[model samples]
Target: MAGLITCLSVPFLSYLGLRSLPAQETAPRTIVNLEVIVVDTESKALEALERLKKGEKFSTVAAQMSIDPNAGNGGYVGEAEVASLRPELRAAVESLQP
Candidate 1:
């Protein structure tokens, strides 16, 4: 019947239209297992980074300088999927190499 064809065609056309839409880009994601030493000021954070570049032990610097609660735990935040993080943080984490 005409009514049946029309109903079926509507859904088929709708499906085609939806399928033609461009796919959205998904953000990059990765598992991360790393330590961080959080400092209160940018200057202090830079200093910490410098220390790391010079091969200072991460746990020692974290214990001495980090303001994060996890400092006592040697700044271990454990594993996390970068995509599950907030947008800015996810982007930052994705830019880094292992």
Candidate 2:
């Protein structure tokens, strides 16, 4: 009776674990260079966006406007996984051409 109950429980437990996972079965795996500019306020974020639109060097803009500790390193975030990124950033990355 114990062996029969154990076999029945295993499949149910597996199904529950699978259901708890993210719905996005396959996250983007390719690595891409990402430029980031983190600012303290909405106004600052707008300013950084304007700089990017003007074709300013991303690293230079990042160094000047970003308050992040790694601002000096040109804001190079290196390769990243889409699943690990915030929703906004993930959308940006998804828009890029492969």
Candidate 3:
């Protein structure tokens, strides 16, 4: 009887252990390719936006007007984990059509 009880409890304990473990993420991690043009003032940012709307190449405007160090590289900020981005930036990225 003791051996029977031990056998039953072993399976029960294993089940409980499995239940206690965190759920694994089955989805693949998302990566985002990003570019940015940082400027000191809102007006400058607006100007950049207008240029973009007018069909000016982003790399060109970034090279000429961005104050960021990456301006030389056309404001290339590199790839990032979408989950690791700031909330506002994540929202903006998510809103894009592509």
Candidate 4:
């Protein structure tokens, strides 16, 4: 009975160790960059921004005005982490107060 108990405890301890181990979570299906086509031509960036200001869905405006040739498929330019744009566009995007 003692030997059997120890054997049972070994598996239980193994289970506990595994359960406590950090779980590796894959990122939620990454929004593919291809999905956010930013048509950002000098002519078009503002048009899309205007639509966003008017409360249009950003994705919709992206679809319509993203200047990237693939805009029809995935109009994304990944992201523009605040400090990265040209001072003017950065000012414009940051000023949106979104």
Q: Which number leads on TM-score?
A: 3
- How well is each residue in 1-98 modelled by candidate 4, as lDDT tens digits? 35542211212246447434333443333122223446547567676777788998766776677666656554555644555556886566656632
TM-score of 4: 0.36
Candidate 3, residue 19: CA error in Å? 28
Model 1 lDDT tens row, 11-52? 224744743333344345668876778888999999999988
Tell me how many residue pairs clash in candidate 1: 0
List, residue by residue over 1-98, the lDDT tens digit for candidate 2: 35542211112237447333334344447666776788999999999999889999989999999988769988876777676788988898888887
lDDT value, residue 67 of candidate 2: 88
lDDT of 4 at 87: 80
lDDT (Cα, 0-100) at 75 in candidate 1 = 94
Which has the better TM-score: candidate 3, or candidate 4? 3
In candidate 2, position 28 carries an lDDT of: 40
Question: Superposing all C-alpha atoms, what RMSD in Å does each candidate have to the true structure?
Answer: 11.8, 10.7, 11.1, 12.0
Off by over 4 Å in 1: 1-29
Supply the global lDDT for candidate 3.
0.83
Candidate 2 deviant stretches above 4 angstroms:
1-28
Backbone clash total for model 4 is 8
Candidate 3 lDDT over residue span 14-72, tens digit each:
74474343334335678987888999999999999999999999999999999999999
> Can you give the TM-score per candidate against the true fold?
0.61, 0.60, 0.70, 0.36
